[model samples]
Target: MNKILEASLKGEVLVIKTEGYLNKDLGQDIQDAAQEHIANGINHVLIDLEQSNIVNSIGASIIIELIEQLQETDGTLAFCNLAPIIEKTFKIMGLTKYCSCYSNENDAIEAMS
Candidate 1:
């Protein structure tokens, strides 16, 4: 499937919602997009994955990188609308230990506040 990475500025938090497959290549795009916002003074980021179904290893790597970067700046990275499979993958990979997971984008936004 085609990869889609659309980003928006929501309040003080930068919201990036990913659709399609999140593979190694697209993963980099996700990182780049998030970085663009952080460069513009957005420390809190929320990635809404409700529309995403498949995420490869490369995507997971980039997600980890985003979490690390956010942490260094005393920022936060939250995830929402994750598929059960992807959620299991993240938990197995220990992402949940570092990043926060929400049931939906609204909850994620509220947490960002």
Candidate 2:
């Protein structure tokens, strides 16, 4: 299951908190919400993964897809509260080269702002 914790505006940035699994099944919804907010001119974003785990390759692909979309708009996406396994996975996949990760949501928010 995928849950959108909430969407908030912090100055010029947009923070999107996601809970639960991120898989191909939930990819579209995630993309939709992000695009909707980006359409409103909220570009910078922080995704909090504090409550989620178990992201498969498909999930990672979806996240990459979202990253591509955001990149096209010159927007940024940062991740927070990532598990060690997921963090390593992301690093191995070269995601860390493009996206930033923080120890906590507050740090992520600060990084984007």
All candidates: TM-score = 0.93, 0.89
Question: Could you give candidate 2's per-residue lDDT for residues 1-113 as a string of tens digits?
Answer: 58778777878777777778776765555676788788888878777778777677787777788788788889888888998988988899988998999999777777788
Off by over 4 Å in 2: none
Query: In the order shown, what is each candidate's alpha-carbon RMSD?
Result: 1.2, 1.4
The number of clashing residue pairs in each candidate reads: 0, 0
* Candidate 1 structure quality by residue, lDDT tens digits, 10-92: 78878888778888877887888888888877899888887888888778988899899988899998889999999999999
- Where is model 1 more than 4 Å wrong at Cα? none
Q: Which ten residues in a row have the lowest lDDT in candidate 2?
A: 23-32
User: After best superposition, candidate 2 residue 15: deviation in angstroms?
Assistant: 1.4
